[model samples]
Target: MKSLSIQEINTILNGELVGDTSQMIDGLEQLKNAQPNQMTFIGSIKYERLWDSSKASAAIVNENIRIEPGEGRAFIKVKNADLAMAKLLEEFDPGPPQFDIDIHPTAVIHETAKIGKGVKVGANSYVGKNVVLADGVVLYPNVSIFDDTTVGPQTVIWSGTVIRERTEIGAQCIFHTNVSIGADGFGYRPSDDGRGLVKIPQIGNVIIGNLVEIGSNSCVDRGKFSSTIIGDGCKIDNLVQIGHNSVMGRFCIMAGHSGLAGSVTLGDGVMIGGSASIKDHTVIESGAVVGAGSGVMNDVAAGKTVLGYPACDSREMLKQWVALRRLAKN
Candidate 1:
């Protein structure tokens, strides 16, 4: 582990130090598990008890939170403790050598593939023919990039993820383990025989923008006509399902287990809480927040907050909740 003095940590985090600067912090650990040489962070004041009992050399905390450690442990105060800790961890862990021109010996790169400079292809990964991987892309073990797919620079794909043919992923995107992009959309027609279903050919692709993070086990289906477009800075939580032809605008957040039906259009900064479902062809405007477990059946205007099985106005939902509580008491 790389070692840095308390002063250096403070400088790196831009936090104000409350103790000796010369003290060295070799590594980081959880607040409850940190030892004398490790640093920990107090992300919330609720964890004050843990901070008080922590044997850590130093702690990173918010500027307003004041805690006195019985021992002479140093305190580094910042605007947001959690954010500061994130920056510090990035500095300490500085993941994988930034530039690796070498592909792992076990990786199978097709002869027609075009791999750019500084790309790292891990063990057992497969890059199909005509695939284009730009610079600084990291493919973890078991990742499968199919033919005609193009991954932009600096995209990191975790293990077991599969990008189907012709998918285009933008730069700085992060795909967690088990993500499946460009899978055939759920479009089946009843066959004339009446005993079987006819599968439609998904000739379209998926276009993912920069800074998008798709969580583990999520699936984004390709369209039957045009592409399923996910705009920049979108954050998709685990187990979510994005149907074919869905267009998600910039900075849209979709929580765990949520599902969007095909052709849905989500405007910029739309926030969908856990397990929510948006019906097909629905348009949710910018800054709209869909509450957890809600099923949106209609178009939502910008900046609206909706909640319920069939989502209604947030204020109306609260009123109903209050009434239900009172009725139950009666």
Candidate 2:
């Protein structure tokens, strides 16, 4: 518990001190659990119930909120107390600073690999031959970048993520933990003997544009023949599956558990709800919304909202639901 006077804390957070400047605060804690040497913030009205029982030495509170100041307890009022507290917390509990030109000895980098200035490769990471990692890229521990892959500058890949052969990821992209990019697509062929199924070869790569964010545990399969592309500024949620050869346009939002089959094309600003599934070869236009648990089997026009299994217009689906309810009432 590092202690700082109220005046020092105010300086750190760039906030005004309205109470005792000499009061000491050891650390930050929640309203209910804050001790005599700790400070807490009233960020939400839902936490107002904790005010009466709080035992903290001081509290950072909004300027508009009124609270009775108890004996020996200080109240620091600020214009935006939540943000002030956030700044204070950041000052005290800062994350690890960005690494500059540091590569662990355990990391394997091919002699021919092109690593730009100030790149940081963590322990047990592998950079393949002819791979290009641009300036300011940070590869977390255990990351794998296969041969001929190129990652643009300032990309941060979390631990245990895999970037398979020839995949191209752009600048400022974030790959969360356990993400698998460019894995083989699910394809099968009929056996020559007509007795069983055989796996088809996946030869194409995945290309992710700048500023795209892929969540943890998500998988983007490699194309069976051509490239699978995800455009810039797309936000994909956790546990989503983007099948091989799919092309997602800029700023698309795909929620958790959503699945897009092979060869699907989504235009700019498409939004998909949780657990929705889009069939292969389907095209969804810009500004479209696919509702939760919906199954999209055909093309969706621009600026429309669809819902239900085998998705239809949201208004139609709601009408059908209301009719069903009326029948049940009768």
Candidate 3:
């Protein structure tokens, strides 16, 4: 077991220690489920009440919380318990999945493809003609990289992922399992004589910047003419759908199941909560926050927070909700 003593943990967190300094904590868990050999954190006031019944002999707590450790337990007091927990999790992370081969025998590499040093291509993966795989790039089992695509150094693409032609992926990006990049945009036009629908030929690619992380099963569609751009440090969550020609600025975060319709533009630091849907061609400015379950239909100003259907300003939505509740009771 990989264990850390109370004294060792306090040094790493630079926290003030309270009570016993000798307990060995082998794991970290939630308050409701912690074992005696594990540590837990009470990051929010909502969880503080549950701490009394927890079996943990050690805990990390906020400095503002003034409770002493009971009995033989220990507590490490820090500025923020949640932030401390994140650091601890990084310490315990075992690193990415490891495969033994540099390039598996079953992987198909085209004659014209250029693979860099230290690249690891797993079983049944396909690298098509004119593709470039940079140094330290990892393609897990069953990944498909189409012709003319270029992946930068240290990018890790998980199993079952697909990269379409002409796509450019920057350094240190992570594409989780089953992600689809540069697929055709959803575009259709009415045919002549109104007989049937005609497909719009999507000829564009996707450009992803460095340090981007896309969660499992998400899809980023190709543009109609140009590129669908995702800026550096963007984090897109599981099952998210980013439509054609959409441009996301640096450090933008989209939670699970959130979607951006065709050509949507998001400025730096925009936060999209889970299940929020932004309409086509809408622009969200920097630092704006869209609450969960909202359906946004228009532009959102910088640093503004929006909520509710046809998403309005958060303050306006609150007033409307209050008025509707009052009218309902009458």
Q: Where is model 1 poorest over a 10-residue stretch in terms of lDDT?
A: 93-102
Model 3, residue 58: C-alpha shift (Å): 1.3
CA RMSD of all predictions: 2.6, 4.8, 1.2
Q: Which candidate is the best by TM-score?
A: 3
CA-lDDT, candidates in order: 0.92, 0.90, 0.94
Between candidates 2 and 3, the lDDT winner: 3
C-alpha TM-score for every candidate: 0.89, 0.76, 0.97
- Report the C-alpha displacement of residue 239, candidate 3, in angstroms: 0.6
Rank order (by TM-score, best first): 3, 1, 2
lDDT of 3 by residue, 173-231 (tens): 99999999999999999999899999999999999999999999999999999999999
1-330 per-residue lDDT for model 2 (tens digits) = 567887777677665555473457878988999987889998655666787798887888887666655666666778888788888887678465455449989999999999999899988999998999999999988999999999999999999999999999999999999999999999998999999999999999999999999999999999999999999999999999999999999999999999999999999999999999999999999999999999999999999999999899999999999999999999
Q: Which pairs clash inside model 3?
A: none
Off by over 4 Å in 3: none
